[model samples]
Target: MTAATDGTRVTIIGVGPGDNGFLTLKGKQAIEEADLVAGFQTVLNVVIPFAKNAELCPMAYRDQEEVLDYAVGQVKEGKSLVVCAWGDLNVSAKELLDRVRRRVDHVDLVPGISSVQIAMSRSGISLEDVVFITLHRRDGKESALEELVYYLKDGRRNIILLPSPYDLMPAGIAAGVIEDGVPGDHRMTVYQRLTHDDEQSWSGSVSECAAITTDFSDLSIMI
Candidate 1:
């Protein structure tokens, strides 16, 4: 299906975690070809160099819907568009992708490396032994928490989880899992700003992570 009534395409490109070098070649090409580009300010910053020819539309949580609506209008006017997201679209940007799909007939996706992949690589964990979960959505915290508890109790596979930034950050997630009967002594590591030059990490028992007082960067994942 074509993206809009005018037959222009709408592509959603995952720009990788933080570093521009991680962006896939196809993603760069899409950005270079876009008539308009839209995404969160941080994501836009990562792709700005490739999008010199495209109109950049940066949005925050408060204005994302409005910004996307404007993008959809532009697409209908026959402009090829690209919406940027951090990490692989299938991993954590499904909600954003769905939003675009609701406004257009079809949307193309280009996957990029995720922080989860970087974490697994750094920790030497195989994908076959991990269960990935993201708590970054606007809703369904209860269900996601229940799933995390179930996995913790199962004890068969390691977990790589992306905590919700606004509420359930690293400490909050560690506490919640412990309260739900996941052992406080469970070993965990939190990685922040993966792929960035100043990336950092903390490793400790769940109890120790729960007691952490320092505010973590918004870009962080626990494994």
Candidate 2:
């Protein structure tokens, strides 16, 4: 489906990392002005106060195609839709924006505090010095590992978005890095549920982190 040709538009808003406090004023305003707010329930819940007047469309994490279709339909019908993206809009929002651009006349994205940023803050590292990679539904595990192995070996700090497929949590990723020539004693930190009430941070060597069997929230970040 295509967008309404008569100047109707949709706004893609990044709601920031899983906390309402992190929502930008502009993002909150966009949500309040929207006729329809579409995103994962966890993300949308953070902005519920602003979106109370808007029609809420809850999407599952695995339903990107369905959510895109819903947003496209709403936009084509002349509704002002605000699609909420987790983290920075440029991250998970890329695929949706690519498809929407082909069907819509105009779309704008509001930046948010990515977990990478929060993780960096928690670790006291400069964002300019970290190589960022997201394994969160980008490609297969093997490909993600290869990318991590390639980048982590550069001697620069890295911020990686861990994929929760099966058992590929921080521990697993650390193990993979260790096997790929990153020293077991290499320092690393894992941030879980950043900006949330139950947030936690773990700091240790790669091997020390690998030995941890505890599970973390799906929103965990490693640095």
Candidate 3:
């Protein structure tokens, strides 16, 4: 019988930039020994090779509820599990992890390199020079947009964008800033899937840049 039959340690793992290479040694070890791989199946697909013996959890929205429930159930049964995510330690991750923690006395956050940090590093921008807004809220907020516009107008601030998978990305954002009267030629960089082999980048401005029709499914944009 495998680890599932006897049960073992269950965790929510961070896969880091959708790259197996970015996975930490410990994280890889846990995944390899996990009884079940539970997470957004997109991320699951990306890291399947790492979880040689684990069962893949179906990709489901509101996976938090089911994933949390399953992990707790596994721990009770003594079977190990590892749930994956982009950053398994952020706010969204925290809220989800809290649910399982409430039920089980044991759980640990396995950290991974955040795509945001990777993008910032790749862009060569300091955290001090950037204003970050994670637009992935239930209710969107553009208040940051105003300040971003002002900063762009000043021509000195580097803007770091954590755009919601919902609203404007770097290209759209640049377009809006330009429409608001900021310099249309302001340089922008969109690091889609940073730290991954498929990672792509583009540089241009609101006034002259072409449409960005690429996959921003898991991405970070900098300007």
Query: Once superposed on the true structure, which residue ranges of model 3 sit more than 4 Å away at CA?
Result: 1-10, 91-95, 98-103, 144-147, 150-156, 179-181, 209-218
TM-score, ranked from best to worst: 1, 2, 3
TM-score of 1: 0.94
- What is candidate 3's CA lDDT for residue 61? 64
Q: How far off is residue 193 in model 3, in Å?
A: 2.2
Q: What is the C-alpha lDDT of each candidate?
A: 0.90, 0.78, 0.69
- For 1-223, candidate 3 gives per-residue lDDT tens digits of 4543343345777778777788888789888888878777767876888777877775566666866676667767767777777754663455456665676555667888677778778878787887665555444447767777777777666767666664666657667777899876666777777766777787776665536665465466565
Candidate 1 lDDT score at position 2: 35
Q: What is the lDDT of candidate 1?
A: 0.90
Model 1 steric clash pairs = none
lDDT tens string, model 2, 1-223? Answer: 7555546577888788888888989999999888899887888888899987899988885886677688778878877898888878776556656766676677777888776777777778886787667676645757777878877777756655655644678888888889889889888878888888899888899999889897767878887
Q: State the lDDT at 179 in candidate 2.
A: 83
- Could you give the candidate ranking by lDDT, starting with the highest? 1, 2, 3
lDDT tens readout by residue for model 1, 1-223 = 5334445458999999989999999999999999999999999999999888999999998999999999889988888889999988888787899888888877789999988889999899999999988898988878988999999899999999989885889988888888889999999999999999889999999999999988998899899
